[model samples]
Target: MNLTYLPLFYDLSSREQRDALNELMARNPAIQLIDNILEQIQELVRVLFPSETIGEENLKQRVEVYLQNVDLATYGTWVYYPWLEKIVHLLNEEDFIRVRTSRNMYKIDQKEIATLGKKKIGVLGLSVGQSVALTLAMERTCGEIRLADFDHVELSNMNRLRCSITDLGINKAILAARQIAELDPYIKVRCYTDGATEDNLDDLLLVGGKLDLLVEECDGINMKILSRLKAKEFQIPVLMDTNDSGMLDMERFDLEPDRPILHGRLKVLEGLSSIAIAEQLRNLSFPEKIKYLSEMIGIENVSDAMKRSLPEMNKTIVGWPQLASSVMLGGAMITDVARRVLLGQLQSSGRFFVEFADLINDDPDKDFCRS
Candidate 1:
């Protein structure tokens, strides 16, 4: 089933766009038409005057004033989502963004939002990366997001991935792009279905203006190392979440151009050229890859449950186990850190954990009123 995720925008004022819209409607007579432009304009009016508390009649008057008494049907742009066979009417880009992100005011501030709108973020894997990408879109954290993943959705992935059952067998990267488009069609998205590799690494990081930040989540040990090498070469910061124990890795290659990838954990790969590193890692047995992965992520820092689960892989279990809770937490953590990093509010490189297991007390006998 071929599908296109990008939404098409039309300005009816233009004769060309008007004909295109007419042709689209004629071609797909069953397409769903959704026009909520009036409500959208009402919300936009409230956003424009956030300090005031206006009644429903007053709000309607304000909306009319803002629209200059223009007819609501022709006031804004028409966006069509081909995948869903639906067309929606909403305020144009600038006003839509302002109203959509109105609640982020002061917390993100107008200046910071503008800055974020100019930033581009790259995500290499879709398992946990989907959460990060969607979070970034919902928060309007960045203007463009690049996704790369060669894998397809499977029933087993439902435990952690936020995708519908109908998406099974769909490329993960494409699935994420579709989701992002459905949420906010304005955010730009590019998918690398081949996944990040030695050949595409440079293009992914440098092609469309070097990525401001790279979130590396792919499972391949080689790509993990190679992607960072490319990011370091381009002086781009990297962020990663292991989807376990709330572990997050931030490599400020932008701030410290000389910093070793993964904090020098995989020293075996230090001296080899990118090609040699790929070849060498490609020949490693499954056990060897796991060994290197443990070293890279610090086996000592792994949670007790994960350490136990690792030994049962391909035996009692299929592969590494990940929970929905951990994946959600990872998404939140990475997005928060990403916003801070992009805004220049955070500048450091190291591993951090927001371990819920450590923060909560399970003891039933603890005092109730202690300070």
Candidate 2:
């Protein structure tokens, strides 16, 4: 253990550092195996000192010296991944976060990155929401995340979701959390397999400090409005990406606690009970649902494709079309907006359209060459 070489672990006593190293090595055989030590050292040296080339002889000398003085116990310990019904040994949190997110520096910056790590964000749906949740984790945008998705992964979900066939039937929330754990075990992920509802809304929003922001991507129409209602009550900002025509809806309830829900869409929905709203949306014809959706995002801003899909819903198609492109775009879009919103950089909220059609068509700097 050369304290000078690994300054980050200098705070720990020799015994503690040895224990951490041993624990880490135990789980990672490549690090523990004598035959692989040189290779490991070479890789580490490359990553640590990319600009300075240390030859194999020098690398071995460095690694041997470091290993000789470093005697730690328990390289890793098993963590029960309840969702997958398995226990697995994982790397310690600090080491994991450090190495995994080391490349995200300067671009994310220290100030906003620090702010993001302290914020606890909640994701209510895991279909397209899974993309948002995982993107958030991948970016190290939040230290703790609450995922609430009742649906299990089905065959159809694989079309748009970044999941394998082996994961079919697992709860979406748990799946998302497991993926997050794999990416950054340091991130605190809490899953609600039952999904966010009236019974658990309070716990989801207020538990472990009221959520800094809530990303509502649930399919339940009533839950969408209801979650916003609760978010407004608690003064938490909400971000939702429709995954249709690149629509991103933002509600800055934290800024204006009394801000109208869905931007005051469908005023007829004002007095309707949640149960009534749910029932209405559930049974509405495709045209009716489109009408409601139009109100939510504003009819003028709605995409032509989105408007056209309503007629086919429950007819030629069992549900509206969802593309992997749109879903992934939604994830990136919402995560960026969520990051800005969480950092208080984005002060106002409204609907934003990032549709490819409009963007390329209206490009002011583009010149078309007619063939």
Candidate 3:
């Protein structure tokens, strides 16, 4: 993680350096406007685009002409990522609002987009949570987002997560943060590298002020319940999406503070504290945890292959199966629900499954396909 960009002009021939400078200027009209506004266009060009044959007077005239149509106030300072070194012109808030969300159109009105952009969101677990986090950023739904995941990117995660091979072994939380940074620099990103636990749960949930919403998708059953407890305590809404069968759970503690966590689905978790739950599973072997996870997520909710493979974990396979389609769909659906919840248009508290079975089972052409 080197975060520095140093252009080595000394390595290039004078002609090549000049050509590079010309290319840079051609690509960034924002810098030209900045130079013109400061009345240092000539000096700036001379400093950065030095040439033996081109006189100072000639350079000044050329730069001044190039900046005639450039709008100085429409953009601010140029920024480049330390690692990638790609320069980007910062846009004014109004211009940014228009350009970043131009495709949202009539679906999300400008007022709603503006409102959503100011809200803060938190996402736990980066495997499937990565999609949800990125989707939220894509919609410009939340201006500030916090991500928590202690796991590193493994080759196995590529099945559902959208990342290249180069991302292997990187911290999932940081990977998500970096991707979000590259997508929208205006979005403030925070990551808890250690994942959510008693040590950092407060910071993640309440210390920096309660998050507008929490999206919990971690493998830790305790976190799944504990996070909801905290959300309920703070009267903050929480949303989660289990990729299988498009099962989505919305717990609007703000609307119904007394609502049972997970709609009281797992009776075993009714009165258990997170510490007690952790102690109960502390002695379980790795394979046992996998099998326990299958049960925790509801064995019936998973694909047949995943359910079948659970028993094979210690003897054959390493983990469960996940599909790119389900992960991506979880991302899109969670973001949609997050927006609705944030905008106060939805206040329901229950489970909703966006499964294809309903559609496929009801299809009038089903008999034709079967025949």
lDDT of each: 0.89, 0.75, 0.75
**lDDT tens digits by residue: candidate 2, 12-119:** 335676566556556754432222323434454455665777887777776676557553324333344333433344434544454466677767776777778899
Model 2 off-target regions past 4 Å?
A: 1-68, 72-91, 271-289, 361-365, 368-371
Q: Using TM-score as the measure, which candidate wins?
A: 1
List, residue by residue over 5-50, the lDDT tens digit for candidate 1: 6789989878899899999999999999998788888888888887
**Which prediction has more favorable TM-score, 1 or 2?**
1
lDDT of 3 by residue, 322-353 (tens): 77888898999999999999999998988888
Candidate 1 clashing pairs? none
1 or 2, which is superior by lDDT? 1
Question: CA lDDT of 54 in candidate 3?
Answer: 58
> Each prediction's Cα RMSD?
1.8, 7.4, 10.2
lDDT measured at residue 44 in model 2 versus the true structure, 0 to 100 = 49
Give the winner by TM-score: 1 or 3: 1
